[model samples]
Target: MVSNQNSKNLYQALWSSADILRSKMDANEYKNYLLGIVFYKYLSDRMLVFAVDLLEESASDLEEAQVIFTKAMDDGEVKDDLLYALKDEFSYLIEPSLTFTALVHDVYRGKFQLEDLAQGFRNIEQSNELFENLFEDVDLYSKKLGATPQKQNQTIANVMKELADLDLAHQGDILGDAYEYLISQFASESGKKAGEFYTPQPISELMTRIAIDGKEDQKGFSVYDPTMGSGSLLLNVRRFSNEKGFINYFGQELNTSTFNLARMNMILHGVDSANQHLRNGDTLDGDWPTEEPTNFDAVLMNPPYSAKWSGEKGFLDDPRFSMYGVLAPKSKADFAFLLHGYYHLKESGVMAIILPHGVLFRGNSEGKIREILLRNGAIDTVIGLPANIFFSTSIPTTVIILKKNRPNQDVLFIDASNGFTKGKNQNVLEPNHIEAIIDTYQKRVSIEKYAHLATFDEIKENDFNLNIPRYVDTFEEEEPIHLGELAQEIAATNDSLAQAEKELATLFGELVSTSPEIEKELAQFRQLLHGGGLE
Candidate 1:
């Protein structure tokens, strides 16, 4: 149970240490250095608790909390089972004597222990089977943290000491909250580069809703993201999801480094590796074990924009691409990613993917893919999101929801592009924007200008072009230029001009409505001519 006060303390402490490194490194680089340290701390704390539990359970000479509140321990068999469970639990094996705080306190006491700190991080990552290679090249003592070994180690040690002061309660409180706080802080500062990795919270919330709404009871089916970044998108689904069906989380990412971060994020968010199987490789090229693909209920993604791929000639034969009768263009692989997500979706599963607006209107092979998707009614909904919501990209993106089963042949088009606000450096959707989008999806409501339910005949007439303008009619005709009003206004202006000419002894120039100087002078002349010169 983390109180708001405790959360604040954790935020301030972690941010202070991270802030020290801001001037020393780029926003992206600082993330590795800082997240590496925080993760190191979490592992250290877990290990320390495990060590103490072992000491107490076995009556060994180590500090341990008295089992004050548990009557179930009265059974020796129960005690044995608990011990075995703790031993098997990688998340619970830490000892208090070896806590991160203990080590950092030593550093604050004049001990420059960089080697020890580095080894501690390595040991914890190695100790956990799934988290191996988790902090690759995140060497806190590297030249990236500082120039020389002495300076690097010294700064690294100081950073550890500062973080030790933070009150991040484990399992559910401080550490986990602080990790999210840091990820957001770093993401915002990193700009468009961050967008490539992190999906904004509002967007993720909406995606999760689109995936999990109405599926809360049935279990065994899973949800996946083919291009999992920080794992925030997957983990958050579990948090905000309102599911009537059970969904085990799954995903794959080409970036091994981000894959590791995704795994760590899932664990911190209370998802065991047993529940979420994250693969590290290009999902498009790799055949995710048949078991992984066949179990999903939903999939959500915000893949890299227009990523270049081996889109070789033979790729037309790949199962994910071959079915469409054409390959996605070599240069822009938006639909390629979409097809991959679509293939992984369960027969009745739903998947929502973020893509550039070009995917809607781009012709050639891309148009063919769109035709196949719509012809089969795989497209459930098309949502246009506000701009700057993504990190490395400020361009507005659209979310394409593909369902294996659509009861109706009508495609839902939502023009929510103008629904967000401009944040300090980026565009952001508030809760209202997220809710409106989610409600529209749930109710399938038709908003006059915001959403349209377009039939297949209409879409076919547009030649399979899913461009929003064709469906939503967002264009506003220039409020009919009033020629009659213009003539009458012109006559009034001419009369005023005559009066002004008599009063100011000068000819009046006709007002050019579009001109800046004429517009300003018109007011002055109108007043002077209509009611004589100014007092």
Candidate 2:
């Protein structure tokens, strides 16, 4: 078992590997290489452990096991059995020649070749259909790594040596969380592109908790994120559900590189390949997860804000949008994504999506869609979050929760904009704030100034507008003034001013040797004290 101290040490060691290449490339470019190598180390360690266990199973003692393993390395039958077993178990295999331990030792001995590790990645990618093209983003030969082959080899060697010092095989979440931590650090540094691949952790937590509130104990519980970025949001569902219960994870990412990151994140966090189904494609244009049924137990998303899509008339027949009878405008695809995910959601499941405030009040096609969802009682709750809470954009956002066939057509509106604690760079929703919102949502009651339950009649009376302030009144009134206290305070201030003027006059008389200009200034000051100064 790995101790807490050992885990912390491992995280620090793994993270420092980036410092070696910090000057050579930006986080966007260097992340692929750094994380790819760390994943390689994990795969290598896993294979070695499996091999050692296989050797120990048949031998009498540990020393005898090592001797048997050494002898088995030269036997074709043993090699074939080990390869088949490892491939079946891990969906990939690493040979002794290209294992991370072997490569690190080779670098120390001045006999390392970058091609060996590159070939290892290729072989793994080819070993199983699940791992195909997984390492396509890791380009060791890119100029970003180094200019020349020898220089690239040295740079990689330096990173390898730094990573080799860390114990990544610890039986804990240390390595996986460290990888996530590094991804977040890069996201913070990547600016606009951060939103393309990352959703801030706090937001992910809040959305996941709300989506999985009443369905934690259900067997074979599954969750889906249509716009899954880095697979963080989809993976967050596991924390709220039974850990031993097999939960199927599904997601689709538009960007190829981000899609690869999502896959790598899934594997690094110990999610079996059989449980993860991620696809790289345009989620809005394509029907995703072609192999599985559409309905999911919970659907969560934080898609690109107001993204553009082809709202052509051809989509009028698309089952996802056909019922609405109008497509989301070409300029903003927010509703398009919602409707797509909504089509795939189980009737009993809940969907909580993060979108900009415009979706709540935008006119034209969006308004029509809002009216349809409102009339159908699909919109469950609208939560207003604080601004500057997201790293990519500072616009105030809202989480729109939807449930199919909710008996009570009332929509719960929560005004949590002022609930965040201010940070140096961004506002943050603490755990208490998150729980408060969830508690109020679960109880389905109105809290003064923070939440309100807007009945269907009231919403229709307001013309189906779900703006938060319209339902929850957060306006604070000013305090009343006291004229008597004000008069007494003014009189006291006048007396103090008179006393100050007299003292200043005496002091100026004692300093008669000063310049005439100083004397004139003091006379003016006295006049001002007596309320006789020129304006």
Residue 478 shift from truth in candidate 2, angstroms: 1.5
Q: Write the per-residue lDDT of candidate 1 for residues 1-535, one digit (tens) a residue.
A: 2457767777777878887888888888788877877776766555444534554543221122223103224556555665466558764433323456656656767765676666666666666577778888586656776788778877777677677654333446455656766787788888767765578778887887788777755565487888888877776666644441234778888877678777777767666567878788887666674662454778888988888777787877877788888888878888888988888888878898999999998999999999988989999899998877777787888998988867766789999999988888878898898889989988886789899988999899999988887888787778788999999999999989777567553444344478888788887776676575422
Q: What are the runs in model 2 whose C-alpha is more than 4 Å off?
A: 1-3, 57-71, 243-245, 483-535
**Structure candidate 2, residue pairs in collision:** none
Reference-based TM-score, model 2: 0.89
RMSD of 1: 8.1
Query: What Cα-based lDDT does every candidate model obtain?
Result: 0.74, 0.84
